[model samples]
Every structure is written in C-alpha cells, then in structure tokens.
Target: MDTQFFLSMDPPTVTYQEKRAGVRNGKPFFYEDGDLKAARQKLKAHLSKHRPKKPYRGGVRLVVKWCFPRGKHRDGEYRITKPDTDNLQKLLKDCMTAVGFWTDDALVASEIVEKFWAERPGIFVRIEEL
Candidate 1:
C-alpha cells in the first residue's frame, strides 16, 4: 500500500515529532522522554477510572504514529522513500505518552477504530494499569 494513505488513514490525534529531529512535517517533537512522560500521564487517568465502580479493571492500549508527510511510519520505522514501510516503534512509543488520553478522543478522532493499535511493541511502556 502507499505510505501517505496508510498514515493519513488514522488522522493522527497527537501531534508530535522526534525530541530534537524534524521530518516531513518540517518540525521537531518530544520523543526522547515522550514515552515516559506520556505513560505516567496516561496511567494517572487509568487509575482514576477505577475510583468509580469500574470492576473490570482493564486499561486501554494506545498507538502513536508519526508518518512523515507524504511518507509512512509503520511498525517502528519511517518510510521516507517511495513505497515506504517500517516498524512503527516511534509511533508506538509516542502513543505511550497518550495511554489514558486515548479514549478521550472518541468524539474527535472519528477514525479511532481503523487507526488504533492494540499493543505497545519494542518499548516497555505497558500500563499494567490498576
């Protein structure tokens, strides 16, 4: 499949870039500590959900995608060239920063169903949420 179509399919909710690197979007983002900070913030909200009668005790998994404009960031790698493909590692890590906030966009991120990924790969940002 084409790269742009793949990345654009999701209409990324979280707007971010590598900590000190710029790419297709012509801007840099917080990637170095993005996962750590994102995970902490997400867990905070996850735990809050438990305060109420939330016996299920299930935390959601969020996926972060940073496909370069006109390119693809899949799996964990950025496909900058034509017919691009990668491991989406950065994307997943970035999503870690948005663990708890995933559901928050249910109303705004309309393509949530097609765009969301279930697991956090490469990085150990699992939110064994309480």
Candidate 2:
C-alpha cells in the first residue's frame, strides 16, 4: 500500500534536538524546550488529521519534503540552513507514531527527506510498503 499527501502550513523550524537537560536530585533528565514542545504539539495536531485507517506493520519507505516560506531564497530552492534534517525528521516521526501512522517508526526501512523554500509552505509525505 502507498499513501501520499501534502499538508498546507508553515513548517516549524524548531526540532527535537533542541531538548534541554537538567539535574534533579543528582539525576539527569532531558526535556523538550518550550519551542520544541510547541512545535511538536502543532505537528501532532496537524498529523492526526491524516492518520491511515490501519497502521503499517511491514517495512515501509518514508519520504518527506519540508517546504518553508521563501525569504531571500528562490522558491523551489533547497534550504541549507538551521534545523538539520535528522532533527526535523525525528520530531515528525514521533508525531507520526503518536498519530498511529504505523505501529512503530522503526518500520520505516527506507527514508528520503528534503527541505526547500517555497511560496506556499507545507509538508509533503509519501509512504510506501517495502
């Protein structure tokens, strides 16, 4: 099975890597920063609307295209700035897991992630059974 969709909204730049660390009673703990928390919540809310009827149990290929609002960069140009791809993908996969797109994100045996500047910002996702 293959599922593809485009989410129309400004993609958040804050990523999961922005976690904060603190010591509590001589124990270290990690927590998401306020910006990261907000970003995750926003993504979860949007992603929940697109959950598949059944979670993918088998291996799957996941593709994500993150389109950001164009600033000085030309539309369709690759974004080579802050918020590295891995960090962005981590947060997105977490939200996908929460929304039950699949039993677990580990089912994603292949992934292709990209970022670009665009006049209409959004997230484009394609999932295919492998």
Candidate 3:
C-alpha cells in the first residue's frame, strides 16, 4: 500500500478550551484530554484499513482527503509546487533533510509550489509535487 509519513514539524500547539471559565481549563490533544500519539496511531490505523488507492512518491502527489461537515474549516487541497528540474531535485533533497531522512544541506525555503495550497496559520498540510 502507498503510504506517507507526516510527523508534525513544530510542537503540538493545537489548543482550545471546550469548557467555560471556572469549569475546566484545558489544552488541545494533551495527554489529559487525549493522547496525540494515539491520535496519530489511530489515523495511521484508519489509513491502513482503508488502503490508499494511489501511489506514494514519498509525499509527492495528490492526497485525496475527506472532511466531515463540522470540519469545514480544515477543508483544503494541498500540495507543494514542483520546481524546475534542478529546483525540484533540490526540494526533494531538502525535504528529506527536513524529515530526517538525509543529512545534506537543509533549507525549508527551497520547496516551491505553483498553486496556492493554503496560507493560513496552524495548518499542517503540504501537497508534494508528483
């Protein structure tokens, strides 16, 4: 099965209090509220069960996604832009380095995309150039 590994780059900063003041202050995905590690595991389990229908080029293609109505805010089609031949090659190199797959010169700015995937903050999706 085609699969891609997506380890959150930054720390888990997703936080929101579901209860009112004095009720119970809380953090998002925290161990007390929920196990984020388990969430990742659950997500992986779900994916493994569904069996992706496309090929995984080490995260270099379209990842068809599904969203429930309540998650309208998270709806998006994301992908990193494909740079020119040399740039594309360099991007792949940097991406590997960023993900700890390689140890070459690393730079996040090297990845370029032709389309507007998303520009909002707190977003954790990137469409890789296929």
Candidate 4:
C-alpha cells in the first residue's frame, strides 16, 4: 500500500543530532535536548493522524519534503542552511516509528529528502511499499 500526506506546520529545524550525553553514576546516558524533545513531540503529534492501521512490513521507499517559512529566500528555493537532510530525516523517521507508521524505521530501504523555503510552511511525506 502507498501512503501520502502533508503536515501544515513550520518544519522544525531541530534534528536528531541534538541528543545530549551525560554520565550518571559512572554510566553514560543519552537524552534529548529540550528543543529536540519539543521537536519530536510536535512531529509525533502531527504524524499521529496519518498513522496507518497496520504498520508496513516490507521494505518501503520514503520521500520527505521539508518546507520552511520563507524568510529572505524565494518560495520553492532549496534551503541550504543548517540542519542537513540526513539529520532532518533521522528525527522524522523516529517520530514516524513512534507514531506507528511502520513497526520499525529500519523497514525503510530507500529515502529521498529535501528542504525548501516556502510560502506555506509544511511537510510532505510519501511512503510506498517496495
């Protein structure tokens, strides 16, 4: 099955790379930064409505277009700023997994991710079984 959806919100620039590490009782632990936590919650909340009834079990191709609010850049311009594409996808896929889009994000065998400046800020996602 194929699934596609658009989330209408400013795509958060915070990425999974924001996870912080600390030592507790001589043991190392990792935790999300406050901004990263907020970003994950926001993405999960938006992704919840589009969750599939059954998680995809086969390899899947995932496409994501992150559209940020247009500032000085023109609409549709490729965003070449902070937050690399891979980093952005990492956080998003984590949220997708948490929201049950798939049993595990490792099921994703292919990915195409892009970021852009846009008049209507939002995220566009397309998932196809492969």
State which candidate has the highest lDDT: 4
Arranged by TM-score, best first: 2, 4, 3, 1
Model 1: lDDT equals 0.32
- Model 3 lDDT per residue over 21-126, tens place: 3333564432324543433344334334333344233534323222112223433443333322343233233333344332343322334333223323221224
Angstrom error of the Cα, residue 114, model 3: value is 16
lDDT of 2: 0.93
Q: How far is candidate 3 from the true structure (C-alpha RMSD, Å)?
A: 13.1
Tell me the whole-model lDDT of each prediction, alpha carbons only. Answer: 0.32, 0.93, 0.32, 0.94
Model 4 lDDT per residue over 1-130, tens place: 8999999999998899988999999999999988999999999999999999899989999999999999999999999988899999999998999988998899999999989999999999999999
TM-score of each: 0.19, 0.97, 0.25, 0.96
Root-mean-square deviation of Cα positions for candidate 4 versus the true structure, in angstroms: 0.8
Ranking by lDDT: 4, 2, 3, 1
Candidate 1 deviation (Cα RMSD): 14.3
The list of candidate 1 runs beyond 4 A from truth reads: 1-17, 21-87, 101-130
Candidate 4 structure lDDT:
0.94
lDDT of 2 by residue, 21-76 (tens): 99999999999888988999999898988899999999999999999999888999
* Candidate 1 residue lDDT tens string, 4-59: 11222322222233233445577654344565455445434433432323221234
Q: What is the lDDT, from 0 to 100, of the residue 91 in candidate 2?
A: 93
RMSD values, in order shown: 14.3, 0.8, 13.1, 0.8
